[model samples]
Target: MRPLVELVGAGYAYEDGPAVLSGVDFGIAEGRALVLLGRNGSGKTTLMRLLSGGLRPGSGALRLDGEVVAHDRAGLTRLRTAVQLVVQDPDDQLFAASVEQDVSFGPMNLGLPVAEVRERVESALSALDITALRDRPTHLLSYGQRKRAAIAGAVAMAPRVLILDEPTAGLDPDGQERLLDVLAGLRSAGTTVVMATHDVELAVRWADDAAVLTPSGIRTGPAGSLLADPELLSSAGLRQAWAPAVTSFLRTHGFLTANAPGPRTPDSLTTWR
Candidate 1:
């Protein structure tokens, strides 16, 4: 499948500051999940901003569906509608007094009919399993609740691509699992999902492809192949993913055949025994 969006040699930096991202070349196919892995200050957020139209690339090109992205008001507006970004900080994204109003903001901005906007808002809230919090004030919600509300706002926009930065940063384990399920549902519904995170285990289990951002550039490929390499992980400031570590342990202890299929999820580990 052709990529829904792509960056070719894309580079960006703030005024007089050193380049945060340099020579980034990657593409995300429709309905797929891409995990961006890096330590803090590794340019994950900068790359997300470029992908979401929050900032134009200072060098190279960014394209959506084979066309170069335009920077004009109308062009950028269209880009925003097609690719919605949920930043790491929900506090920065959520401003409305109530959850329902906040989630409704994006669709309503599109000038859709009231009924359509309402339907979208309802669907988004239901998808995130946050309908009960619809009328609650944003200030009263827990951190995870506020995060879900922020995601709902992006979902209401119905973008082809959803970019999330450090999506699991503040969630408990249960909340993280719930958010993963929600992301899986969105993938099934044909929304391309791009997530930037420090969680190597999450990337191993969830990503169709993985990209590791470094100060010099990015290295990207199938998730399994990339996560299985300790050298690569070390260079990217990440450890080997959990599955590989477990598999290696089982192999050294003669608990499993060397030809066993690599397990991507913990549930699949039972196959080895």
Candidate 2:
């Protein structure tokens, strides 16, 4: 599949700060769940900003649909319509008094017709399963609810690519599972999902592809096999995800075949012989 968004030899640096990311080449393919992983300050957020048109590259280029993205008003407006980014903290993104109001903000700003805005808001709320919370005060929402509400605002824009940063950070296991279900629904409906997370286990189970930021630059590969490498994980400041011990035991004990495929999620192990 071709990338909906791509970065070729991209680089960035904050005023006088040493370049945090340099010589990076990456892409987010259409309709795939891509997990972005790295140590603190690994440029995961920077790369995301570059993709979403939040930041212009200091060098190289970002392409959307195979064309270099323009940084002008019309160019950005077009880009914003197709790509949306949700920050990690819900509080940072949520400002309106009510969930419905907040969710409506993006489409409203896009100058969409009232009818279309209303339709998009309703569709987004339903997609995120937050319809019941529409009239609820944003301040009154729990962290998880606020998170969903923030994401709903982006979804209302009907983006082709959705970028989330540390989406599961504060959630408990159940919250994580629920969010996964919602993301699954989004993918099924044809939106490409890209997440930046530290949870290797979640990446193991959920990502179709992964891009890890290393000291040299960026590394991209199939999530299952790539994340399973301890050296690679360590180089990216990540600890082991799941357990190699259990997998090794299963294989040696003949409960799993040596060539058993990843992601090797629990369900994938249920029928191993």
- Return the top candidate by lDDT: 2
The residue-by-residue lDDT of candidate 2 on 120-179, one tens digit each, is: 999999998999999999999999999999999999999999999999999988999999
Q: Which stretches of candidate 2 lie above 4 Å from their native place?
A: 243-245, 248-257, 261-263, 266-272
Instruction: Give stretches of model 1 more than 4 Å off.
Output: 249-258, 262-271
Model 2: weakest 10-residue lDDT segment is 261-270
Candidate 2 lDDT (Cα, 0 to 1): 0.90
Report the lDDT of model 2 for residue 249. 68
TM-score for each prediction?
A: 0.94, 0.93
Q: lDDT (0-100) at residue 57 of candidate 1?
A: 96
Residue pairs in steric clash, candidate 2?
none
Instruction: Tell me the deviation in Å of residue 157 in model 1.
Output: 0.4
Residue-level lDDT of model 1, residues 106-199, one tens digit each, is 8888899999999999989998999999999999999999999999999999999999999999899999999999998888888889999889
**Residue 225 error, candidate 1, Å:** 1.3
Q: How many Å off is the CA of 206 in candidate 1? A: 1.2
